[model samples]
Target: MKVPVRKQPSWFQVLLILPGVAALVVTFLFPLLWLARTSIQPTTGHTLSLHAYARLFEDSFYWWVIGRTIFIGLLCVVITVPMAFPVALFLARSQSRWRGTLTALAIAPLLTSTVIRTYGWMVILGRHGLINTTLVWAGILAQPTRLDNGPFATVVALVEILLPYGIISILSHLSRLDTELEQAASLLGARRLQVFWRVLLPLSVPGLMTASLLVFVLAISSLVTPQLMGGGRVFVLATEIFNQTTIALDWPFAGALSITLLGFFGIFVALYQRILQRVESQS
Candidate 1:
């Protein structure tokens, strides 16, 4: 049997796509081009130079910042996946009437502005805030301890902020899975733990990887949470870029930093795609 020939798009079809294409070009492509152009330009002259990039590379402090950023991203992934997995699994498998409400609650964090959520965390983690107040009242501490403006606060806030993305990624995959394989494992004398470890977990690797990638990328690129929670102490790439552009008035260096951040994203994306491909081939 001959396969049906695909039809070419009509003028009307092309017309409908024009506005979206134009918007993408205006919003994303043009800005990206501008950023690339700015990254190479000299601070004073319009002449192109790699001075900013060289400066970034030669500085040990910037290298430390890069490493710290990567560490934070990895840390967020490590914390988020374990916490999100159980929630995603429950949401995927539960037969309860409140499943909808539970899922909604899981994603409800996204509805609020990130700045608002970060401030909420500030209230909870501040020196005289809820945690310290309770600890002091209970005689657990002699005085209220400082919690905010540190790595601990930044990590905690980031984990909470990125948790929803992890849940959504894992849940989408889990919900699409064939349940029969899990049942079959159980029938073959496998215990619940054995079934999960041997069967369900292996199948869910793709979803876990996706969640990890999403959380890591977001964590590294995050500025506000780290800025507020870090209280100018935490220096991630995003915050540093903000400082370079706004405070330092080093537009070219800021552009270089932005480019470097994009490089990190590109490298991780390539690595993840390769790993995902290998996993898919094996499965």
Candidate 2:
């Protein structure tokens, strides 16, 4: 008997992906190309120059801002992951009837405008805001303190805003986990904490890494929350880019800053891939 032959997908099947490819090129690739071109081009002439990059590297203030941005991103990841882990575990493992409602509640903040949420945080963290007023009323302090125009307020608001994303990422991974593994570990005389640390936690590293990456990128790229909550005190890259674009009308510098931010994205993504590879190899 002759060997059976397999048919390949025809041109029609390949054509189906063209629209998506076109959309990606238009939306992502085009913008990236524009940014790259603008970053090197002179503000007045068509000639290319590294002046913007030179200025960026030469300025100590810009270095400080970059360091601050990285610090805030790391801090957000650290705070958001642990806080989200329990919530995600509950959502994933719970058999409660109200699970859907609880999940909705967890993500409900995303429905509201970020501007409105930032403004709400402002009210809560302002000098005469709820915390200060309650503290003073309870005789915890003599007066209201300035809380809205600093890194503390920025981090708090960012955590609240970014928490849902972390929860969602971790929950996605947790939901797919095998309950049998935990049961087997328990059967082997492993305690609940041990089972989690040794089995579940190790398996859940990918989700945690994804959540951390999301929160870190969002925290670093965030503009409105940092701007309003920082009350002009915070100077993140996003805010600086906005300032360069709108206030200073320095489009070339703005583009350069944008490219720098893009570089951060690329660096983190590479780091995440490396870590993920190691985790998978060990597993």
* Consecutive 10-residue window with the lowest summed lDDT within model 2: 5-14
- Tens digits of per-residue lDDT, candidate 2, 1-283, equal 9998878978997799889999999999999899889889988978899999999999999999999999999999999999999999999889999999999999889999889988899899999999999999999989998888899999999999999999999999999999999999999999999998999999999999999999999999999988999888899999999999999989889998999999999999999999999998987
- Per-residue lDDT, model 1, residue 14, is 100
TM-score of structure candidate 2: 0.95
Give the per-residue lDDT of model 1 (tens digit) for 33-52. 99999999987877899999
- Over all chains combined, what TM-score does candidate 1 have? 0.95
Per candidate, the number of residue pairs that clash is 0, 0
TM-score of each: 0.95, 0.95
Model 1: lDDT of residue 257: 96
